[model samples]
Target: MRLYEFEGKQLLEKAGVPIPKGFYVTYSAMGAVGADPELERIFDELGGREVAVKAQVLAGKRGKAGGIHFADSPEALQQVVEAMVGSELLGETVTGVLIEEKASFEEEYYMSLTYDTVARQPVLAISREGGVDVETFAREHPDKLVLRRFGPIVGLMPWVARDAAAEAGFRGRELRQIAAIAVKLWRVLVDNDARLVEINPLVRTADGLLLALDAAILLDGDARVRHPETNFPPRQATGRPLTERELIAQAIDEGDYRGVAGKYVELDGDIGMLTSGGGGSITLMDAVAAFGGRPANYTEYGGNPPAEKVYRLTKVVATKPGLHGLLIAGGIANNTRVDVTFEGIARALEEIRPEYPIVIRRAGPGEEEGLRLMRELAQRLGLDMEVYGADLPMTESARIIVEKAAAYRQKVEGK
Candidate 1:
């Protein structure tokens, strides 16, 4: 789960990290004319000072996309805020704006505390170069990036923070302040079960006070039960807001923990994909695209999900519009029963009877029975379906589906 900038800043403030004074103004609050008296009062409360109007969307690169605007006066701020409230930023609708006091910073630094999956440990990365393109800078000047890895047991020690800050070119009092912020940030990560806590442009003002100019926090979705107090809305993997179907899929998964049947992401394509296994799903998606197949959605169901769960998931996938074909392929499963998965898919097929060509390549436990069930159902319903097993490569199955979908399209187009 990714928290919005304002939410992340609130967490930072609570963790004792200094952030600029800001308040969020929703689109509804801005009114249609953006002439709400409350907005004017908010500007006045900030002493009519120079402020920044930042669009509060989930995606990044907002600055490059004109989502971040600077205002020297209340009128300019209101204009900027109003302009952003209704616009779209990075494919997400701008529903709110974070109006924050603009600060004069003498220097900007980069800092992030995140879990390094490869190392399986908490890592603190700091760099003197900070801004919107910190990533590009890091890639170009790897030496400037200071990294410190902390053990799971010891966590991020104060000494480690000091060492990282020193390496990032901090000195004396400023180094101590940076180290303190690092500790607080580590605490934020641990206390919130966060996967990443990043503060770009940890700026130092002319007065020598360090403050976070921008914040981003991503919590571990699986660990949500650990932090029952945090109420964040569901979001897609791309960080865009979830679609209605995606939300429904989430609810379906949450309702039953019997099997891992909840990995569904809607994409802009014509082929509906039902794949399994993490690596397998990725490979299939790439293969489908490589073969000129535009996948409508990505779905994974394994661990032998029940018939009802599979039925619901298949129903969701089969009903997606613009679907020219359906590809059901997966890696050879260890425990997931093929028959059970097919039963659910067959049930959904019996109901929806999608005209698109369907391809299946499932080979695992109860493989014969599963393939038989799918074959019988397709024959009984007079559906255009092709079944495969481990004998044929998954990528080959993807190619067949692409060809079949193309043939169907040509036939439909009457060309």
Candidate 2:
């Protein structure tokens, strides 16, 4: 779960991180004109400081993409606020703008705590070069990068925090100040069960005060059960709304067995795919696309998904009207019998009996039994089926599906 910028800022503020002063404005209560009075009042309360108008979007690179702007004057600020509110960023609409006082920067730094995939643990990263993409900074200037591993049992200690800042080129007093804040940030990361806590432009003032210019935080949904106070607002997709199936899949992550298993995502293509195994699916998708077939979906039928479950999911995929083909390709897992998956496939073929071209590539445990069942079913129903053996690699299977789909498309277009 990802918290909106405002929510994340609230948490940061509570953790003693100095953030720019800002307030959120909603669309319904006030048109930009109606909100003028309140805005003026806040501006007056702030004693005349330059402000920033930023669109609250989920994705990053907002600044480069014109999602952020500066307004030195009240009129300029109002114009920016008016332009941003109700606008869309990427594919997500902005409900409001974060009106914040601009900070005077003497120096900028980057800091973040994120789960490290390779180590399978949380890692803290810091850099003296700030306000830019952290990944880009890490890649371009490896020497400026400072990384520290955090253990699950002890979490991030004061000594580790000080060392991280020192490694980022901070000296003496500055290192001490930054290190204290880093310790606090670690506490926030752990106590809140956050997946990420990033301050990309942590700034220092001429007077030696440090503050966060921007913040982005991602909550660990798996740990949300423990934190009742955490909240996320409704995220409207910027372009078209998410499909019903996508929303259903998104909602399915509330309990045990909740993670979205299999590689499944919606795409703007003509073939619905249900391939299994990680490497096999990747190989097959690339092959399918390379061979001129546009996949309508990406799915994986994992080792022995319950027959009924697979049948139900297949029925869902079959409902896509634009679907030109279905590809069921994957290397059979050594441990799971192919017959289990075949049972589901057979049931789905009977249940949907979709008119679109269907392609199958099967191999693995119970390969003979699975093929026999598919062949028997095809014969009994008088349905034309294409089932291939696992002797062919995933790429070949994908190419066959793509070629078949292209032929189908040509035939339909000709008709």
Candidate 3:
């Protein structure tokens, strides 16, 4: 979950990080900001000072895109807001603007607490130079950027934070101030289970106070169950609106921690897939494509998920209107009960009575019973299907499905 600037600011404020005071001007206030009494009254509360009108879009690099506009007074602010409210920025329509008091800062610095994959731990990064992309700045001026890795359990302590700030060239009161803010950022990360909490351009105002001018946050999608107050809309990994099947697949394992049956990404193709295992899913996708089977979606369910989860996932995958075949395949499971999992899948097929050819290639504990269950389902339904165990390699399973699906399509089309 990547929060909008206003939402990130809310979290920062709650954690005691000084941020430019701002209010969200929703698109509903686009033409009404200056003329409408209510909207105009809100602007008056900014004390008629210089303000920054920022487009509220998930797209990045707002500064270069004319998404951030400046105004010295209320009339100017209204005009800026009017121009921004409905404009398109980086392919995303601006839905609103975050109006904030523009800070009079002499120097800009960068700071963020981000999850580092290599370290397998969250690391706090700070820089003397700010207001630009941190990665670019670090590359250009590595000496100015400082990084400190912190243990997830111990967190960023006060002493280490102050030292890190000093290392970034801050001294005296400035060092103390930035160090305190750093700890607060760590709190924001841990408390929210966020993978990233960034304040790019941590500015030093003319008054010598530090205020965060911008924010970027990304929460762990898997940890979303722990935060109930959030209502962020579901967005595909590619930032597009999710399809109906994608949404259904996404919600399958919401509250259940038993196993994952909900990792799904919809694709443009005809073959439906229900695969399991971690990296195995990607390998299977590649195998299927290599064999000319266009997987309609990439989905995996494993770790011994309950039958209902698999059953739900099965329905979501198999019922796609244009599927020529359905492939239920995975590596030999280590702990996942194939018999139990297959029961759910078989039950779903019984209900769907799909005309498309189906393939089940799975092997693990209870593999015998599981293969038997699928074979029985095929016989009872008189379905076009093939059931296999570990005797056939996963790649071979993919080839079989592609061959069957292609043949079935030809027969149906009289080609």
lDDT of each: 0.87, 0.77, 0.86
Q: Is candidate 2 or candidate 3 better by lDDT?
A: 3
lDDT of 2 by residue, 235-269 (tens): 54334466777565444333425222333467889
Best by lDDT: 1
lDDT of 1 at 405: 91
How many clashes does the backbone of model 2 have? Answer: 3
Ranking by TM-score: 1, 3, 2
Q: Model 2: residues >4 Å from true position, as ranges?
A: 26-49, 72-78, 115-122, 150-152, 233-241, 248-264, 277-280, 290-292, 301-309, 333-352, 363-377, 380-382, 388-396
Q: Give candidate 1 regions above 4 Å deviation.
A: 32-34, 239-241
All candidates: TM-score: 0.91, 0.81, 0.82
Residue by residue across 210-275, what tens digits does model 3's lDDT show?
Answer: 999999988888999988876676644354556788788888989888998988888888888888
Clash pairs, candidate 3, are 108-130
Total clashing pairs for each candidate: 0, 3, 1
Candidate 2 local lDDT, residue 89? 78
Q: 1 or 2, which is superior by lDDT? A: 1
lDDT of 1: 0.87
Q: Pick by TM-score: which candidate is best?
A: 1
